[model samples]
Target chain A: MNQEQFEIYRHLAGRLIDGQLSPGSHIESEQELARKFSTTRMNAYRAIKQLERRGIVSRSKRAGTRVSAPVNPNLLRQLKCEMTRRICVIHSRNSYEYLHWTGEFRRTLQQALAAEDFTLEDVHLDDVRDRAELKEKLLRLTETGIAAFILSVRGEEDEFLIENSDLFFQYHNKIFVYQSGAMSWMHWPFHTVTVNIFGEGSLAAKYLMEKGIRKIAYCRREISSKNYLDFNRERLLGVEFTMRRLSDGRNKPEEWVGLEQIYRNCMENGSGCGLIVSTDELAARIIDYFAERGAKRPPEMISFDNNSEYDSYRLTTIAPPHVEMAQTLGRLIFDNIDIDSECGFVSYIKIDSKLIINHQE
Target chain B: MNQEQFEIYRHLAGRLIDGQLSPGSHIESEQELARKFSTTRMNAYRAIKQLERRGIVSRSKRAGTRVSAPVNPNLLRQLKCEMTRRICVIHSRNSYEYLHWTGEFRRTLQQALAAEDFTLEDVHLDDVRDRAELKEKLLRLTETGIAAFILSVRGEEDEFLIENSDLFFQYHNKIFVYQSGAMSWMHWPFHTVTVNIFGEGSLAAKYLMEKGIRKIAYCRREISSKNYLDFNRERLLGVEFTMRRLSDGRNKPEEWVGLEQIYRNCMENGSGCGLIVSTDELAARIIDYFAERGAKRPPEMISFDNNSEYDSYRLTTIAPPHVEMAQTLGRLIFDNIDIDSECGFVSYIKIDSKLIINHQE
Candidate 1:
């Protein structure tokens, strides 16, 4: 139930899964493991006991302890087969707790993978109380064989991968990160599944432009917070690329136009401008904002991220297909799991988003 | 019934899956599509009609024809959820027929993915009767969105990947291949799931050595027939690396030694030599060969591949864990399916085999 038990248990189990701890091999005693992990002896013993419950280890009073031999290939297979493999989303405690967007993504991701019998849990493994706890969780996550992670690493953890790539690579191939629209490509070197914001952005622009809206505007989220804005700029870059291609570079949407000004200008002029907001939430907000302003109607609008909130608008949005992404993500991850060692090139698959005129997740 | 219908169907479905064919867009009429594909009109109509069956397209006398707009996201998901995802093993007809070994691997792979609801079949897409059919099947396999493949490339198909990598890359991230031990490294660039023949070879050497068999012998099948000999040399390299580490390598088994000579020397010397054969079949032949020579008993023996034939001896074998490999392959393939596009390098996971003492699968 506590972090200590979970940490110790996950790391040792990971070792077994990675073949780092061979079957029937003697392991560091519970006492030795506790000292090694700088945890209380009780935590280590509890961790091993958890492994025993999973048929990953065996213990006896007469003999000390060891990773149990695979009982029989058929039985070992059945034990593995009977269980559903878990995939967790590892995010900072703040992101999971405070951010509505992350929660939305988690819910959507779970819905996506649920069909495949994959359970996506919110894992606050990195949010331990202290350095020792964090160390234990990190070790457990990287070493324990229990589950794979969809790591949304922020701030220091990005630095952690750079500093400890080998220890990370020991279990690196097992985890996945989202492709972000961040300016810095720090996580570019690792395994990533991302929406092609650039391509989708451009494509959406072309599609919207063809609908005959003369004035086009771009909307954005407030960047006052520094937590996870990596994709913010990239999303715009995609939109601008499309604008530059279609129109004379003369009257482009100004950089970082606030929603208030955008709403005011379009309403005052009664110009049915084509608006590209950062998300479906913003799209709904603008429509509501116009209604609140006593305007009879709003401008032609489109948004990104097909969150379920936009279901009522019949709104046009440039949204990453979550279930399709999950399905593709499933296909991509499973495809490369076999070739990670031999193929050194990271494959950045471009997930194309569609311009949905109506409907939602 | 013919390759054209299959190709036309798979390719259009691929376009739908890839978003190239927008939902609710007017597609080429059956006559147009048939003309475009250089096929009979009936074939194209059948292909499009098949798409209609999948809820992808809708046809009527008044509406003409178009990609069906998903009436509801939940309903669309339900329709997709009803489908069975196919994972195929692509091979030449010659390879599938003459070599029964590939059948064993296919069975193991099926058993492994069976739990995940994936049915594995040997897809002879490459074995089409003619060159045009081969072209159609190859294009269909790579570009079609219907199924993922486990490509067992041999002779010409390896060259096929190099020649048409773009079309291959279009959907190359969707299939799987065995991690092979070929010295050329030609096949490593593609997606592969393979047994760690080298590592398993090394560990088997060490295990038999510890059990008191000093002089190690390596046995192999002939490469003249050109079947799946991916791990042929690497298996020996593993044992040799271990032998060199354990003792002087002056008397180690030479490469490609015929079974007759190896059987004669071990029987004549009575020096209790440990053996590593290519497979359980070769091991059975060796054991039976010894029996024909009037030896009192079989030498201390270990073999590769845990096919059920080795069961009676409780034969120690160096065979890659088919089910274990399957388990790992499932995890590996599923793990990387989501991340292949983000990761730059192809992941070749090193699959570890075990020293099975008293059983066989």
Candidate 2:
């Protein structure tokens, strides 16, 4: 194509690809375009002919030139290469306000993507009332030129995705499942990022013992009846395994009923009691309970979910590394954006939770 | 000003207002301006003369027409009015990584502002090595035409801000302090928005009781030695006051040692026992401990901070209205953007924590 023809073709195609010129929209006539661009009618004719040949537009005597209703796949792919900067995050609705760390996860992810001139759009998958609604939503969303889709998979949501597995499997390379631990039951191949719950437990136990906790209690939360994915069991194994190994099979950390019982036992026994709570929320409760009563902080303690809320707390916590998680998702999406699923193997990224110590004594 | 002159003037002022033309930078000469805007040199000269009289630019044979060195007060005010769309958030460095909810707050604020085309720039005020350094950094930042400032105050950071009260007091209308509760010691006449920690406590207790909790336990964490500003007391008072009122002075919730003890006690008591944990973190622990043991979730329970991390937990939680808080701050900043400090009075906005019930029966 000559310079003028190339210019006109690029302008029209760009707008059509962006949906600014929808299907069936009439393109400017050759004479009209020739006047607009200050070019010869022949040049305008050549540009329209080029577009028509590519199947991006159709030329007819009565219709003149109209954008192809279905759009050309090759042209759409080119548009995706240049304009696909949106990442879709799937989670339950209103999780940002209720679910802990989700808001942080989203913020970190958004900030990371924004730096690369990409955007994060949240899709509350749980809000879809039924399987059919979810399927329709996913179909429409996937059809749009989203660079990537991040599914913060939970129980019901996981089931929903699996039900629509065929659609997801087709675009596996473009999908990522951010989970707490690998689900052994469900097996659909996609890029999976898991925070090592077991490692967090092990790390917490080790950190507490190193702080001279003679009697370490792994005070896990009572399991919810609705908990199909119980990470506490995995965490408990890590804590128990680590304690046995560190103590040479002598000192096993006891599973306590609740923080209050542990605190009472520690007070009665008179010090050197360390705690490895299940989550930072639990650890914070322990801290607040002691503080309200004017009691000193325990000799040592650690908890998981190094949630950003407890940054001021003087307690060691196991953080899931939200920033790293977000970055990993961002990196995976970027690397696999153009990759074919056939060549892409299912990648399981397991990141160990870090022990953040804000405790001075 | 004629149409040509106005066009040239608007173009130049917009650039200067946007900080594209920094103070002391030489602006386009009259001849250059005439050629660029395709206007008569006399019209360009008249525009330059208007800018000079407005104190936006100065003319000298050696310097040519240059932006004013000190930048005229009125011109700077106009720049602020037209271009100050960037909000400054002061927080500890690396907070986005470690601190809980701080990242969420920042993200929420950024999203809220971005809708209005405003950008949020974070200032790691705690990263400043010394008080002098902090003062210098703040002086420079405050000098820039920032729309408004939001200070997420903490201990040492709060002290630093207090020490620089004189500077903050001057820009009181344009400054907002987002705090957990009011600090009685530091009396700065700035627009203050505080999350009602006391109300959260009261709400939690009331909700737990309403859930048919007979034997109630108010679990608070042990206070850290570094916890100079203890909010547990405020929360405890709220809980105690509400409990006394609700029970008609017949029953009072006992402050427990930790969640384990509460769990053990509740199990022993055999149902209808309720727990009011200080934070959502603590409440999550109770749920986890119960879940770990395969026990039913305590008959009734409530916690505070409604931190987004524990959204999946079924327990009702008292959540600091972060969205409301951010919106309030944004609204205050926008409404008062052009108002003089003399005409604006200090605003104390207290938002009650919402009771987010994810628990069923």
Candidate 3:
């Protein structure tokens, strides 16, 4: 068979073996298949005939072509084994933000990896009872020559991996640590990708100030103490630094750190000022405040993380570059480029933050 | 082997076959495993030996027991086949709310089904190119004696299923139609479950009124034209009906159906009144308004769909009972209870809505 014909056969067989198509089901007509593959009808027929010779499909005058039940299940196993290039995605179990981690980021990463012919397998570290089992799983993946590993984990839950960093030093190059927070350890030397939280704050500040606002308030809810690095503090510092630099160290924006404080500030001077919100959730509450007041024009506002749930609010937001980060990691895996060497001993990669305007897609 | 020993052996083998336990990886110590299973070390050791005998694991004094590479991959197929009780969850591809549908609901359903030793598999209808392919899939599943199927589809995307309703009538008993919107076809005979949108509105109005709300307003963003039933309109009707009945047909709440209208209403007479919002998102904007005004006390507000993203807003919301619905569906599967028989020809089930106060866990 020609290369294109061979590809058609492989694609059809792969779909069947992957359970995308069921046994004994009527296959699409040859003309439809040809249209689908952008191939000639003769070629599609040839592919079907090739499958028929192997007992994979049967053609009948009365019914048309139909997929047959596998005569040998071993072929399924063999086909599965042939797709050995896999990227292992490891994460903590029972993560409250599990959905967030597995949502857009996971989908984008999976799509990016699939484009490179690498399958993504999820391995929950806490799914197993003990640290030993987790280690064993990692060891097995490395032994199997897995292409790359992405560690998408949260605070404290990542303690095991951090503690065992030395053990993984041998395969450090193959590991990518992805966390939204600031990196705690600089010495581990594993390839790291993190959302530029500080940059996001700066971007929000810069964006709002450039819009020619006379005054602004930096609003945040009470900071959670659970994180190893205070992301809010870092973000606040970024905003403060930018605000100072932009105004030649002559101006400081208001900081509304708690609900009561925010309320007091809004009550006293909330009108017509630019606002830099810490997160989308916080921005949502602020939007509600202005909306209820029946303000003719809502204040110029910018927040971090463009959550789709808050899309209608039309709040411009500094969003984490999830897709860009995913694609960058994919490039790292396929190209085997050493990030540290490329960046003069910078171990971690800080993906530039994104500013989504008025919730535009 | 005793029953406990057999269970331990089976559990280990299942883990191995499921790829939860990696091949050639060191197994947890027998004592630790015994502690885990609450069994004696002797039983655990006996189970290990049984696995060793079957060439699934190997034991050595120096390195301890290790899972062995599968000598016969056919055993994997046999074990997989043994899990014949499966629920197929079908949805549209490129569904914008795909994550929402697949997130909490899918997880809860999977957990509920797993409790009954059943597995859930996802099938995207739009992934296939043609209706013939889709029909073939359903036919194959039926031929294989599949346990159940859940159709979690949106408006126009469900046209194919609705059009082919006659073809599916024979398997109506095993088909479940799950949608948040109102069902368009009451006569389809497939078991239906929908969120109580009207009841949610009534409950919100009732809850606010009972709390001595002097004035209440039913607030909603612009109603989308996409839905089969005007959910917002129904919700408003429920609120109005409840308001009038509670106040002896004398009181009617204000209606703010659009953003501009809501803003005008809030600006004119928004304060010190309870608000019944159509969604958590709209409620967020209202909350933001009050917070900005620096009102010492926020207005009593109730909204629909207790989205976690709006948890901080602390708006009392009518939440779809996801876990309860999942459990109910699971019970339906296990008992094979015919709804039509039990409810006097009522084929559909309405799971009660939940009211979340201040985002309580």
What does candidate 1's lDDT look like per residue over A1-361, in tens digits?
Answer: 2456666665665565456777778766889888878989998888777667656678887777887865443233223322225665665443312322255455666665665456765666444665456545655544333245565543311443333332332333355665333322222234555556555656566766777665676776555444235355555555665565455333345443566886777765566577777777777877787788786445466777666655787677776545455555666555443311333333334456667777432
DockQ order, best first, reads 1, 2, 3
For candidate 2, what is the DockQ-based docking class? incorrect
For all candidates, state DockQ relative to the true structure: 0.02, 0.01, 0.01
lDDT for each residue of candidate 3 in A185-259, tens digit (9 for 90 to 100) = 233334566666656776777787777775778887775554533566567656765666565455567777765
Those runs of model 3 whose alpha carbons end farther than 4 Å from true positions after fitting are A1-84, A94-108, A139-145, A154-173, A224-229, A286-298, A337-347, A359-361, B1-361
Instruction: Show where candidate 2 strays beyond 4 Å.
Output: A1-83, A94-117, A153-167, A170-173, A180-186, A225-229, A259-270, A288-297, A308-313, A339-341, B1-361
Residues B109-175 of candidate 2 have per-residue lDDT tens digits of: 7777787667877787656877667756765775576767777664322455555544443332366
Q: Give the top-scoring candidate (TM-score).
A: 1
Q: What is the interface RMSD of each candidate, in Å?
A: 12.7, 28.3, 32.9
Candidate 1 deviation (Cα RMSD): 16.4
In angstroms, the error of model 2 at A209 is: 2.2
Model 1, clash count?
52
Query: What lDDT would candidate 3 get against the real structure?
Result: 0.63
